[model samples]
Target: MEFKNAKEARQKIREGMWTKPTPGLAYGYTQANLVVLPYKYALDFFIFCQRNTKPCPILDVCEPGKYTPIVTAPTGDIRSDIPKYRIYKNGNLVEEVTDIKKYWSEDLVSFLLGCSFTFEKALEDANIPIRHIEENKNVPMYITNIECKPAGMFNGPMVVSMRPMPKDLVQKAIDVTSRFPQVHGAPIHYGDPKKIGIEDINKPDFGDSVTIKEGEVPVFWACGVTPQAAIMRVKPDFVITHSPGHMFITDIKENDLALF
Candidate 1:
């Protein structure tokens, strides 16, 4: 769990020394959602993310065939930086691999999208409890009734990640996260799971469901997984994305990403 910097952490991933969720790894740096698509679909997906900034805040995009994410992590290789990747063929998950070098090609474009983990430190500093981290589990995420605006062939329901916190700290969590718009900022919905089309809060579509205590309310934030949901519906020929909680750690510091 200890790394000198984002690059070093990524090196560990590249070497296959680390193959797990990257929440507590590379502390103080930003973690990003990875999306790799064919050159033909790049423009549409880019526009799709632009249209739905709440769930798909874009941080950087790599040109076709390029693996180096110059804007987010200049020296990092997108092919192996993330601990795990989900390979989708015609919208169905076909493989989950640690290294994607075999799938690398000149027709692929990589995107690094902002993640909510950028604001975890701020919330902890404010004394707000993050139940998932406390329990050493992945943040719970759900596919919702909220639909994303269509951009070309990409369109699907907006996905959200939930965090259970005490009622008293909800406002503080909102305030802390709102300062970082580059990350998914603020809670989109809170209190009721059925309101968002989540039939059972105890069971989540993605990631592990954590305990919701007596005084706690489940706060939902727009998730980076929205893009993956879109791909699932669109049925693209080939797509690469980080597994739900396995993100690509970036060189950018969290403080540099905050708005105020």
Candidate 2:
């Protein structure tokens, strides 16, 4: 799909012009993971994020009943801007649709979390290859043995995304990505899947795994999926989120998320 600008892309979503994965859109803008819950769960979820800052780093949160994301986006509408959304009923994904107008509720509270896309741009800047992007697939995520610090209703194993790179570029990629703490800063573990409880390097818990070429090491970073894993385990009666790879693009630029 073609978009004159980021706002226009979101407008098209509001008009139902697009309904698919959202990578490669709005080139430099930051795309975010979304989590919407009943107002009754917002406070606990907020604290969950506050405590587990890496995987759940928050960008902005909309007030209950507020469609506008004032901090990261001023004109975008959350209910329709993302390419697709997953609606959960009592913790199970009951539906995956292009928009959530039917699920929109006055009592829903929206939270926007930082995405690895924020740091992928940096990897590209440093000449590090992102295999999933090359293969046109979603970055692979896995539920790890690492546990998030629980807060009220939120508690589960930490989740992470993997990217394979040549041994030489791994350090450079790590140094570059470490500068972007808001979007999962650096590699938590590398080379060995056994260290993180991953039994098979080719098998991932979420998204499609890519080829790891000879001499390349598998690198893992905290993933936005951590919250989704948390949600699925507890099975909340009602929860909503952006479909994987279908993120909400914010007005904020990628460079704005960097720490220098």
Candidate 3:
């Protein structure tokens, strides 16, 4: 079935018919990274995200035990709408499941973070080629040396996603993506993967690598998956998040999240 936007994509997930990564499905709607934690840690984690806004941009947060993120999406159930959710117990991923109906709890607090996919369509519209999308590969992501500000139990290196494009088009992509600050806006750095502690440009810590042509430059941007990096270090008793690439599609439009 062909869905028009993220909202529709979310509806399809709610129906249990869609079970793929949410990248090309809702082309223009702003998708978000998911994080669910016990309410005891919500204040600290929310403070962490607020302190490190670039990599962990906040979209909306659901109160304890509530699946709905009232600020951004209306009455949306976080427990069931996403294609996949990763469950962690004491910092170890215990299960990768489609729905968390059995795990839902009043003590859990849901958080929605801005995603980089929300800006890829804009980059595509500007005639800038996104090599990962063309090759049907997951965007390459890395853990950088830069450390994010710690709040209580949260602290880790900044995670970045990379895309290769022509040298001339790099600036165009920068200008295009900079407008969507809500969804990880702007390039943190371009070229020289080693400069950011990335030893192998061809192998990413997360996601698959794509071809880098003779004339293309590897452009890196802060990724929303950063929270996953935090999960390992924070070592909370329980955590629930969307699996890599399988994001929570939202009701918001891509253009709606862009800056004027």
The top-ranked prediction according to TM-score is: 1
Residue 151's C-alpha lDDT in candidate 1?
95
* lDDT of residue 115 for candidate 1: 90
In model 1, which regions exceed 4 Å deviation?
A: none
Cα shift from native, residue 116, model 1 (Å) = 0.8
Per-prediction TM-score, please? 0.98, 0.95, 0.96
Output the TM-score of candidate 2. 0.95
Clash statistics: count for each candidate? 0, 2, 1
Candidate 3 displacement at residue 37 in angstroms: 0.1
How would you encode candidate 2's per-residue C-alpha lDDT over 1-260 as one tens digit per residue? 66756787788877877776666667678888999999999999999999998898999999999888998889989988998888888778789988888888899999999888777767887899989889888888888999999999889999898999998998998899888888878878888988888988888887887999989999998988788888998888899998877889888888888889
lDDT of 3 at 159: 93
Q: Cα lDDT of all candidates, in order?
A: 0.92, 0.86, 0.86
Q: Lowest summed-lDDT stretch of 10 residues in model 1?
A: 20-29
lDDT, candidate 1, at 200: 95
After superposition, which runs of candidate 2 have C-alpha atoms over 4 Å from their true positions? 1-4
- Report the error of model 1 at residue 8, Å: 1.7
Better of 1 and 2 by lDDT: 1
Task: State in Å the error of residue 184, model 3.
Answer: 0.7
Range of the 10 consecutive residues with the lowest summed lDDT in candidate 3:
1-10
